[model samples]
Target chain A: MSIAEKLNTYTTGPDEQGHFGRFGGRFVAETLMPLILEVERAYTDARRDPAFKRELEHYAAHYVGRPSPLYFAERLSEALGGAKVYFKRDELNHTGSHKINNCLGQILLAKRMGKTRIIAETGAGQHGVAVATVCARFDLPCVVYMGETDIERQQPNVFRMRLLGAEVKPVTSGTGTLKDAMNEALRDWVANVEDTFYIIGTVAGPHPYPMMVRDFQSVIGQETRTQMLEAEGRLPDSLVACIGGGSNAMGLFYPFLDEPEVRIVGVEAAGKGVETGEHAASLNGGRPGVLHGNRTYLLQTDDGQIVDAYSISAGLDYPGIGPEHSWLKEAGRVEYVSATDAEALEGFKLCTRTEGIIPALEPAHALAHVAKLAPTLPKDHLLVMNLCGRGDKDVFAVAKRLGADIE
Target chain B: MSDAAVATHLAQTRLEKRFADLKAAGRAGLVTYLTAGDPDAATSLEILQGLPAAGADVIEIGMPFSDPMADGPAIQAASLRALNAGMTLAKTLDLVAAFRQADREAPVVLMGYYNPIYSMGVEAFLARAVEVGVDGLIVVDLPPEEDRELCAPARAAGLHWIRLATPTTDDARLPRVLAEVSGFLYYVSVMGITGTKSATREHVAEAVARLRRHTDTPIAVGFGIKTAEAVREVGAVADAAVVGSALVERVRANLDEAGKARPGLADDVLGFVRELAGGLTA
Candidate 1:
């Protein structure tokens, strides 16, 4: 069945309490229940009210800069010599990545809900920067939790978040990475559930988060559908994007889940490889376990301890994918695949050389697949990929990996 | 599943209930560990339902704190997830409110560091616990030297203030673990963080027997009680077995794969709990 059909519409049943199939339900504590229901009610009301939609549309277009262009990569396509490639320029969004799209929308919703504080967690600090940017704009007290490890690795974005007036707290527990940051963020939210709004970076969390994030980010797919129709006069043959918590991929894929003609592929980070305990390809290598709120695919040991995950790209280094991705993979509506670090490096260099676009290492994983599949597919076939972020935040890491030293 | 059988099943006020129930049903209660609110309010609820029919029985809902000294990486990750999910000490009570609506039988214990409760003030939290029908609370860092703030109030409220006795606790301190502890004595089998491994009954049996001398409260072992075999071993001595990080780790590991919530998986895990419970009786 299509993704839309699989998702609970909540028209006549379950109220607006948030239900996705039988798996998704609002089993929240009583303190936040009223607030969550309020948010759901507001979202529902806003969704139906034309004025609210128009206001959101206006901000998305003018403030956050929505309708992010879909640029066809002629050079890369020609280099590939077979498949046509198009890049959804989310990398060009306000905060330099697609993370801003969801952040801005959530910040706006926080404002509507009368939330005075904004809490967020970041892996590579992209989401932190995005949340900080919007919270600063909205004048909300923003607190961003980043793993101590990520803060050091992604220093530029960490500084950006602080500069944007968000308090960046470094989490020291666990692997001191995204997962730890997420844990700290949760602790903060629980502590201050009264007036705080949590801006989740990915589509991985529970019910309303995955659904709400997908809705906000779905603008990517919605706009892509319109833009693609205008540009190519038809839908693309295939769509692919990197899946960290899968928000970007879901945003781009939600619009085309019913178009059986348009195949969807969610690429996971293979790290060094799926083996050697160095990968984040949960669907390919992980077992089902509970981590970060939901029971989803995770990289863990036989005893159920969450193993540390590694990837050249910090953004895609999470041990679990979003539960919806799990559901989709099980349903076979979309195919889950992986791209290795070596392949991603090649794709990173290829994008730089062929298209002069220094894509983030996360999307370079998707680019790696393009390099592998383009030559094999028919020349007339088209592939649309979400260029989720720019490479600026990753320059140091990339430089170290590629042995390129700058004077 | 007869009431007679359930009634005939010993009244398990202490840790012994887990084993008693497990033996009666021939299935282990699925134990899921979560922080009160990690990401936000919505996700915490989603996680509660995701288990149960899948395998969980006892849900160890964590109360998020600024300092959780007892937890290791994965559980710390989970605690953060629950905290991020928008959990609070007050919200922890709120979680129990929702929990009571759908599930009344499965014992829900609030586990976390003592800071949040201390911050919340003992009396208010104990009252809230009674109001919310919380079965027990595990304040990991609540040393016996200074637990009157929580223990005294919790007992007055008719709630279980479960205490932990690590391998470090000796014959001198072992009796203290049972003296003040109501609900169940969470015997930390190993000397480490909440998610570490090393479930040896040989070391634990001494502690269990030591506690058995003082109070009749159920002696449930935790910390490293992870595997089914380990559960059986711990159950052989302790009145009830507390398997947390392992069960949570199992739930975490099974996510996203096909047939994760199937009856077979539930049966496999439940059967393991039952076997351990049976071992407790055997």
Candidate 2:
């Protein structure tokens, strides 16, 4: 309780109207406003009920594998030869990523709201597979919208979603990427407002979505706090994570926001370079605009038409980041940096060889930053990075990028 | 004015004046919509200049956004065509300015999402919209909860703050949607986006009657209105029938395979608007 009060002073966000310092608000149409409010009310009530808490805890412990380990990367730390590096092993959770942490909470809320259908949008298909898994567990109809471009890149996870009894709809609009898939998902939500619950895959939608998804994912930071104390006998010196709509980063950063001694950094994916104008680093390269039901920094043209974002990792190829991250960036509470695709590839190779852990390309961006920053600090400095996703889903793509044909 | 009429009269803007003129004429008006620079800016301006002569009472020029989530396929493609032809928010305002030069009687509304105006800076855009003689605004994403963002400021700048009341807007939610509209309350006749399935006439009548119980604002029903008979059926219940996708679809149908406007694109679009207006005039 004291920690909550301490953190509240650093993070005063998403007021009742959901404005995170002019970054987030209810920017949806009138048809979805009432239903959005309904979801908010249901979530608020469920948050208060002890039974809801117990059910969520039970599922987190037994189903989704809560309390993912914080392991000291002895070999990687030695290789960097500066800061001691620790990897938060969220990639070990069910479905091979931290996405299930949010999906578990949202699907439970959907069941509580008596919603018969579940719909979601995915970029790398990790969130789609997570949502399909939870819906299948809860015995609900699930539909996932993925862009045609992403479907071609992430075929394995798409097959996983279909195997879990979810309908995967291929979105063929605009650039046919994550933003277009999100637009199509919103269109479906509008048409099916009565019986559907839209489980936004990240911390970026209208009012309650940004706030609710953040709460669901905060377990990562909370567990990290406890484990870091037990392991190092004190809080870490720094935190690093990748940003793709920023669910995992927000999760790992929310609990430690008030710790002024700790430095937090969010890494954005720079496809080629920030100067190339083809990257997905919103805060680095974009101006503030509205899209996907929230006001956030968006990669757009001078006339405010959203441009397609490019990244080697499909998950980080979205044009906008989470609105709360926008607020945090402006507030200067977190340092934002970018890593190019070449750097991420280098980091991926280093981690796989040294630590025997193949990381998802999304978090490879963070590892790239860690590789640079760790060698600059003292050997005793404790730096933590969220290895947010496993690399199995990205293996084929990485092989193709490395000029190897994996049959 | 009676109490209800006085309550609806929030401003002496062009929309209020136009609605009063229509009431004096003893018939509902016809509202037509078009993407501002569809096919090309010159042709779009010509179509805009000819709409009043084609019997359009209220004209809506859609600002083309790269992502039109609330629009159906027809308007979505129309937006793409306009954007591909290099239509911009400034160009859309320019079209309105050019239209106001010839036909100053019909009320003009700029309808779309909020990003373009937000990107332009709210004050600058509002000043330009007023400079171009735009009557009102209908930003679909800016609900009443976000009134402080654009609606209130635009209304104070002399542009009517029109809002939407969807079919899902029950009795509890109607007043919130109604409270922000100083011009006309746009009633989305379906629970979906533009060009999708339409609402039943009985449902719209009941919805309009219920809205009348709440406010005396002029009601304009839109979405899924294709033909003159459908417009006539909707006009029988509401103060005006707003046809958007159908008219835009006509512009699309007249385009060549290379996506350029074939000959007489404006004439084909105006002829459709003229036939749609005949629903009330006949």
Candidate 3:
């Protein structure tokens, strides 16, 4: 099914209770439910209020540096096969990742809500940095919870967060990865509920957040739609992006969800392998459960305990995808697949050597699909891949795996 | 019913009387953990129904979360089972609402992460929980730092905000934890993941003993108290015995290859509950 038609079946607007395909419902605890409902009302009001849309547009254009370029990878296309491939270069986004697009919007919402404190959780540290950057811009106090393990792995991001004036609290609990960091962040929010605004990095959290983050990131697809049309005189046959909480993919895919002619693919991290029990392929191997305040497919045991997830990239190590993606999978509107760690590594290196573009490990999962799809597709068929972030942060890990000397 | 009603009912519910009965009988109470609506609401009701006969004195119904950090694999799986069974706060309350129709004697505590409650709007949840005859709430993720928000509303509603005391809690934190709470103190016997088993260490006994030093709140030790021997050891110190993951883990392990509930599984569930309850009293 086409991305556009799938989008139509789901929602670009709120449901009666403000859900998007059962996944994006407001399933929070009773205490936060009213606040969430209020936020939903506010978001709905804001979306319809032209001033709010204009302000968001202003921030996107000036603060987030929107209209991110759509670049054709002619060299890589030739290197892989003759089929053409293009990249929606979100790496060049203001915070150096696609995260800023959503952060900018959420921070604006926080400002509009008259909230003063901002709390966020980070895995690879990209979203933390983005939230920190916006918090700094808005002069809001930002506390970013990061897992200790992630802090050690992504030191440069920790430094960047510090540079942005956000207090990066290292979460020491439960394997200390993104999920743990998120738990700590949730703890912080509950403790500081009166004044704190949680800037969720993805389209997963209960009500409004999943919808709001998707709207912010939807700029990717909106821009992709316009750019692809301008650059290629037509839309690509397929739209692909990696799915960790599915914000980036949804961002680019939602605008095109109605375009039946345009296929949408979400790539998930398979870690070592899907069968290894050491993977982050939640949609592929997970079941539906309520976690982090939303009813979604999760990497959980039968008793509802969250399983620690694995991935070569810290960014893609989440055990749940955005609930919207879960609904999409159920609807079979978008095809969800996984690429193993080794496959992603190969895709990362191939993009670097052939196109001189070092793609983020998350996106490398989608790029890895190029190897399979490009070889199979007719030379005339085109693919637009959302290059969600840069791989400079992953160089050390990638080089270590490849036995390359960074020096 | 509003959270106010539930809170009032719980506050008026004879918890002190229940304790007196336990002491007179020379029996420690059996606390069973079941995900609200496991195997769907009907089966959950069945499980809850069988508990009293199988020997549950206090029942802790888990409100499933998308991310359950305090749980190990077993209870986590059970929560997923319940969630798949279409458990929601409304549905869980409905279960409690239904359970209230038959039994008002057993003090029912809603145990799970705080996110669902927080998301539900504390006032509304407190009101609804109170209305449904929910006696207490044990939010694993709610730290003492934020209990004021949860506890104050819950207190006003007359619902006991049961606190979890872990081994890591300092002497200084214990008083604050005990201050505004009632019903029981959930003494998490060990640290680390919920399901990963460790020998119920000597340290757990010490932790329970230390809790006894501070407040007189009935203390129930949970988190990996699976086997009867473990329950007996814990029950020796704790006022009440909490058996969770082990019992639920059995259900998860015995799930049909297709992850469905096999017919006639009630015997297996009851046997496990009975054995654990037997150990606690013995």
Which numbered prediction scores highest in TM-score against the true structure? Answer: 2
Off by over 4 Å in 2: A1-8, B1-12
CAPRI accuracy category, model 3: incorrect
lDDT of 2: 0.92
What is the C-alpha DockQ of each candidate? 0.04, 0.83, 0.07
Error of 3 at A193 (Å): 1.5
TM-score of chain B of 1: 0.75
lDDT of 3 by residue, B1-282 (tens): 123444465434545556556766777787888788776677678778788789888888888765664565566567767766667777788899998899878888898775556556678788898888888888764555445547778878877778777665668656766777787777766544565655355877788778878876678777667788887887787778788777777666556887776776666888898988887654
Q: Which 10 residues in a row give candidate 1 chain B its minimum summed lDDT? A: B258-267
Ranking by DockQ: 2, 3, 1
lDDT of model 3, residue A318: 92
Q: What CA RMSD would you report for each candidate?
A: 16.9, 2.6, 12.3
- Docking outcome class, model 1: incorrect
- Model 2, residue B100: distance off in Å is 1.2
| lDDT digits (tens) for residues A290-337 of candidate 2 | 998899999999999999999999999999999999988887788999
For model 1, what is the alpha-carbon lDDT of residue B201?
Answer: 63
Off by over 4 Å in 1: A1-38, B1-282
Better of 1 and 2 by TM-score: 2
lDDT of each: 0.72, 0.92, 0.79
TM-score for candidate 2, please give it.
0.97
- Residue A251 in model 3: shift from native, Å? 0.6
